[model samples]
Target chain A: MNFSDIEILFVEDSMDDATLTIRALKKGGLANKLHHVKDGAEALDFLYCKGVYTGRSINDHLKVILLDLKMPKVSGMEVLEKVKSDPLFKSIPVVILTSSKEDPDIKRCYELGANSYIVKPVDSDNFFQAIKDLSFYWMISNQPPHHL
Target chain B: MKRILENFIPFLFVMLSAFLIAVFFLVLSNIKTLDETKNLVEETYTIINLNEDVLIDVISIESSIRGFLLVDSDSFLKPYENSIKNIESKLLLLKMVTEDRDTDGKADELQRLIILRIADTKNSIINHKQNNLTIEQKIKITLEGKKLSDKIKNVIQEINSRQLALLAQRKHDNIDSDTNLKLIVGVLILVILFLILVGFAILKIQQQKNKLTDELKKSNNLFSTLFEHNPACISLVRISDHKIIKVNNSFVDLLGYSSADEIIGKSENDLNLIVETSDVEAIAKLIQENQIVKNYEMQVRTKNGTLIWTSASIIMMEVENIPCVVSVSMDINAIKKSEEKLLAVNRELEAFSYSVSHDLRAPLRAIGGYATILIEDYKDVIDADGNGFLKSMLQSSKTMGNLIDDLLAFSRLGRSEMVVSEIDMNSLVKTVVFEQLKNDAEKIDIQILNLPSAIGQPTLIKQVWVNLISNAVKYSQHKPNQKIEISSFQKNGQTVYFIKDNGVGFDMQYYNKLFGVFQRLHSKEEFEGTGIGLAIVQKVISRHNGTVWAESKINEGSTFYFSLPKIKIKTK
Candidate 1:
């Protein structure tokens, strides 16, 4: 995926989190064509090109799956597991975006094959820097599983 | 030797001596009757001796008459007749003597001798007339007469001599008897003297005994007075009846009465010493057996209508050779009150611990929530150092949350009421392991093994499994396979629960901190934790009256073990 298709897929439960996440991604210069979902369930549906995201092709361009752990329904861990387990979307990097550092589910995410895990910092600059670091790794350095 | 004695009550000795003396006097009276029968036989023998003397005199007279008849002169005949008359009178006198003395056989033998003499005289006269010329014949007759007369004389003398010898023997026996009687009198006198001396000595000894008894009575009275005055309750009871034989002034005072006289004859049951009559099963026991109920507590009713709790130690005894029970007493109301106060203090301590756990969580949540809000709302404008500073601030919030959680876990240990039951450790671990896996939508390979059912509170016990299993997953977050094997079984009367985790292990030196509140070996940035998971696990196990410990080395995975009491609970 090139910089044009490297728009962020932010999956978070908190509305405040999604807004702050978008702002942080934009500040890192990696926010073009930002797509958002409220929970892990929606993130899965969109990644599989089903539900509201039907007919969408994840093959041409998905940059990163930014997921949150604690949500109303499907947790970020569930999304991570579902997406990483599928041949169609396992190549796409999934980063956990959670409010709880002690989520206890973080290890499960890593075990489920999430590409990266990050804790949402309450401080603005730390939150921004973490976003920047993940975007740089996925878009530039992390050469996505060499296209089949 | 030390004299083994009881309290010598005098009646036992007096009654024993009285029986012995009555048997001795009865034997002495039987010996005196046997001496009187021998004296009557001697008096009858003396009367036979007098009869024998009269018979001898009659035979002499008969010989004289035969001599006179041989003279053949008229004048001589007249004289002889007179002599015969005299002899007859003498004979009559002998007969009278024989009758008086009861010797008739001796008198008849004398008459037969006289009659034979008369017949011989007549035959001699005839022979003289017929043989006119026989001088020699006459001479021979005379000689024969002389011989006959001599024979008669010898017979009378022999009879007298025999009678005299017998009389002398009787006299000798009497003299010998007199000597023997003297010896008997001396012995009897000695015996009587000894008896008099003994009786006098006994009287003196009895007087001394009486004096000593009086002194002992005085000492016993003084001792009893001491007991009465000694400022403590004392009582004496007669064993035969369940009645108070004696009650001291102290006891009388305690019962609020003026004198022991009022309390005498009253028993424990009558005075209500055993306030609840039904509780006197021990009283029945005391009655059935000889027992000393020592250091027992009981409520006794007083004369003033109040009950007092008394602690007493009772003893079994024989007073005046009769068994009785005595007891020493003390009051114990203060100790009871203090015990109740101690229970109240424990309850207050429990309440304080509960409040401490509840108060800790609110501030912690606010700190964590607000910190995240700050980071999310203003992340765009922060500089590099500002970013690091914000991260540290978030670290501080996380640390506080962990502290709060750890404190809650520690306090919960005190509040969780124990509900002991049998729990299957194997099935339980499988379920917990699967929950850990499924709850996260993770495929982290897990392992479990040999588990056993243990007696413990299931809900609290599940916490132990959850915490240990979650700890394995968290620490092994960076490891591949993420294998966790859980096996528990019973051994040595305890159900041991174990979890082995292949994770970034810890130093054995810091193993002590594994189950402590807020004890953490890894930094929060390396492994996300509240630091209270194992602590909660430790607390849970301990509430079941168990223990939690871990063995690990740096870089080697940790193995955690715990044990629960192997109590078997009934299903029904």
Candidate 2:
């Protein structure tokens, strides 16, 4: 679990949803160098190098963070707020992957500097395809900052 | 009050001047009468003095004549002639003074006697001068002369007495006139004093009346200014006829009229001011019941025929003893339009949230992702019961996904814009029933009855028919005969379409929950449904300004009725 090697951070509270998302990413051949956290608090801890992540390098930034809106403890909105406010990790791209395309949530995510917002589709085939395309776009098509 | 005084003051002045004029004429007449009396007294005194002078002249003539007889000389005759000449002139003066009819006869008799006496004396003197008569003859002539003198003295006495009587009468008349003048002058002074007092009182009353009038004018001006310049639209209408009695500037401007005269005598109906006559009736009823209507909303058609909404506050008032309704209206058209827009936006937002929740089925179904992976990865290791449990989990998740989709569709029906057109209900129902029963294995019998055409969005109405017909077919699938009937008829100017199914119906007491979103009367095992079909049907029909209702009895068939207004067809 070297923090420096982690390029994609997935923050989701539902283990099943996380498994599906990771499987989709793995199917797209983008699961290597990916890290998954149970909720927003673990995501923040890992990003800021706190608690169990204290021995990790603080300068290590993920290429992109897939943030879910609703979670236990610290919500994705709070995580985005902390990460976007900090000059050290503000350049890291955040993609809001949530079960809703609600206007207010999407609007607020963008206002908090979310790079992308996508609503999860109800159909399993569409959901899998959406996740695969998003992973490919962020990991392969899009260029990451040199610090990542 | 001041106006009354203003009229009274001039009248009072005129009356006082007339009184003064009357008094002035009375005093002038009295002074003229006194002057006439004074002149008459002076004339009477002159007449008496002239009478005395004539008597003295006669006496002197007699003495001169006697002296001429005694001396028989020319000097005595000279004195006699002088005396005679003086006597003649004195006699003429007396005659002139006594020319009035009452004294003229007396003065003439005195003149005759004096002439006879002078003549007798002259004859005697002539006899003495000739020395032709005895002394007895002279004595007799003298006696005759004396006798004539006595007659003359009597005549003079009578004329003097007449003059004295006239003087007494004139003095009495003068005293009477003086008393009358004093009485008239006293009465005139009292009358003028009374008139002056009355004039002063009138002046005071006039001043008070003028003051009141000034105050009234000031208040009236203030009221008119407020009425004419107030920012809110205000009108006074006669209560009996609803006639506009007066309208302020704002009211005129609000109605897009140039002058109040255009609207003053017109009734609300005459001007077509109220868009809904029913609202007018309602307001009238309220006013009759309460004598006041406050914050009543209505649409007003302006002068240009543009309808605008307003909130009015009206109260009954008395104007010039006539009952009138004074109404103040505020332009609420902008607020009303914005409010409706806001409600529409809110509905859209609600629909968006439902659509967003529809997206939650993705993660919800993903919750079975682990089971899916288990069945795929450990197909041989898992027992049959374990595999069955995982499959049920997946099935439940899929069922939930279907429910979310149905819920989203229901919410979207609320937010979607409707494109209204003429729809052929007969073909629409037939197509829906055919599609719903295409793959059915049950011996279902659906009788499509005669259906009337309707005006609505074809797509939405088709969806409503599809839901209702499919529900009928699905519910009656357990029946051995499986009879479903679709029919439509006209009811209350609306085309009512109903779907009848011989299925396991619900109790009438739970009818309220039949169309509720996610409400289910049967368990999932008994009837496989998301419980959103009736809710969607209700929403779609309601969007067309129609209604949906159902009549059912437990263990009996159900009839779902939905109605759409039957618009009158126009003939070209």
Candidate 3:
């Protein structure tokens, strides 16, 4: 599969959550340039153009990254830390999409330079609307920095 | 050394008094001896003078008689008469003077011989005057007179020599006594000087000792006052035996003992006071390392067998040269109870929030999402009843989700740390009011008075305003002319803000359930709410060290009020 021209790197561990998010993005017509990774490790690999994503151009910067907090191997915090710390990718907007609506987690994500934090609502419609609105905001309404 | 110093002054006083008394007696005896020697010397001189006078008179008589006999004139006879009168008086004086020294009747013999000589001289004189005496007879008489004269001279010499000897011995005694008196006085002066020096030193030492004793007494009183009367329970335990050597009133009271005697002289183990022996060991270890241990929390059993929590500070010290631990314990049972209670509550809230946010929400989301997907994808294939069931399932999940969210918010209100500052209530209420009404602000008759500033966490206070304003707006929505009044008043040093709305207010019978979580007086069909709004308001207000209450009359109006402290609470 072609990895270039990817605007959104969606990282999530739960397949059900990932499917619903992708469906919401698809419904919004924002799924074409988006690439989904299962965990933080895979997301980092894709970002650094390593592992299965080797040979992907480094200059193809992501416009936004939707990161989940709780994951299997490498957590979303680690991914967010690495991406935000790297000067090359720090400019990319990272939105935290998690089911945990804890205050400390939200504060920590923001403190770690997250652009936005959204709780995956228990109600399907609200969650669907949240995803739809977030994707639309990042894709169209928000003006991305040059090189991001 | 201190003991010796304590006894030294009195001992020195007694010794000095004894020495002075002895010196007084010595001087008195010496004076008496000198007086006796003086009298003896005077008596010896008087006796010697009397003896010499007698001898001189005898010699004169002898010479006068011889002159008279040799001249044989009337002038010679007159001289002889005067000589005889002088001889009698002189002999009487010699006899009187030599009475004390009449050894072997020497005075008597001398007197008799002097009389005989005088008689012989008279006879010679009579014979010469009458011309009836020869020269041989006169010569005989003169010879006898010479003999008497010689004897008289010998006796006078003997008496004078004896008196002289007595005077010389008395003089020797006087000199000896004078030397003795001088030596005694010199020695006494030296001894007195030495004693004075010793007395001064002893006095100085006594003064210093008195000062030290006074200070010690004062400090001892101060220490006992601070220790015994201190609110903190204090106990001294011997390190070697772990026996409680001392306990204050507070300690006795803390342990529910009858008196300090009940606790003192008993080990903590003996009394079964400390609940955990390990805690004591741990405290001992810390004290050993630091020489003091502070705020070590432990549980102890009282005499009544009631266990209580105490925050103790143990200091390693010496009491009367015995190594001991001075444990000062504060009865922290009340604080500990509240702390434990708070911890338990927080843990439960956390678990509930976690379940709601992570565990409970996930499955709810999946159920709701799958149902929606089924309805979206299999709408035509499924029957209408199945579609209705799916929709109902989605609706139930949504309601449960709202409940979970409200629960999570309520729980998080407790766990969040509050950062307090001055909150501009006038603006804060207006913002919340504007947000709640949005474009529908013109529909309701909302009156906002001049609200006072309050001290609290701004965000939490804002939430309080949001919940109260939203409730007023929601409840007053049915009124034709909905009047919502927002204002604040000062009550008991707190700024109490209330929102009054003319709406279908609930009955006062359910006032107890007003701020209870998930406790609603109205049904879902009546008011679409999870009944968490007032609960959240109450929680937010309480966290700010304030209170919340409401008054309402059914079908008339309701006024929800919450108080905010004018001053911020100092939090640790």
Best by DockQ: 3
Off by over 4 Å in 2: A120-123, A140-142, B1-11, B14-363, B371-395, B398-515, B519-572
Computed on C-alphas against the true complex, the DockQ of each candidate is: 0.04, 0.21, 0.44
lDDT per residue for candidate 2 within B307-354, as digits (tens), equals 988999888889999999899998898999999999998878786665
lDDT of 3 by residue, B1-572 (tens): 75776677688778878988888898899888888777667766776776676677677778888877776656655655676677677667656656675345766776777777777777767777788457897788788889878987897677667677767877887787789888888988898798788778778887998899999999999998998899999888998998999888988998888888787788988999878879978986897799889999999999999999999998988889998889889999999989999999888878667755776777787888889889998999999999999999999988988887788888788887888788788888888888889988989999999998888889888888888888888888888999999888888988888889998999998899899999998898888899898888888888878888899999899998888778655699
Q: Clash number for model 2?
A: 4
Alpha carbon deviation, residue B152, candidate 2 (Å): 18
- Candidate 1 per-residue lDDT, tens place, B179-261, comes to 66566566556766755765676677778778999999999999978987876566777667878877767677766677777
Index of the highest-TM-score prediction: 3
| Candidate 1 residue runs with Cα over 4 Å from true position | A1-148, B1-29, B44-399, B415-431, B437-456, B472-504, B540-545, B563-572
Estimate the overall C-alpha local distance difference test score of candidate 2: 0.80
By TM-score, how accurate is candidate 3?
0.53
Interface C-alpha RMSD after superposing true interface residues, each candidate, one decimal? 7.3, 3.4, 1.7
Docking class of 2: incorrect
Instruction: Give per-residue lDDT, candidate 2, residue B196.
Output: 82
TM-scores of the candidates are 0.41, 0.43, 0.53
RMSD after CA superposition, every candidate: 18.2, 17.8, 12.0
- Judge candidate 3 at residue B412 and give its lDDT: 81
lDDT for model 3, please.
0.83
Please give the distance, in angstroms, between residue B228's alpha carbon in candidate 2 and its true position after superposition: 28
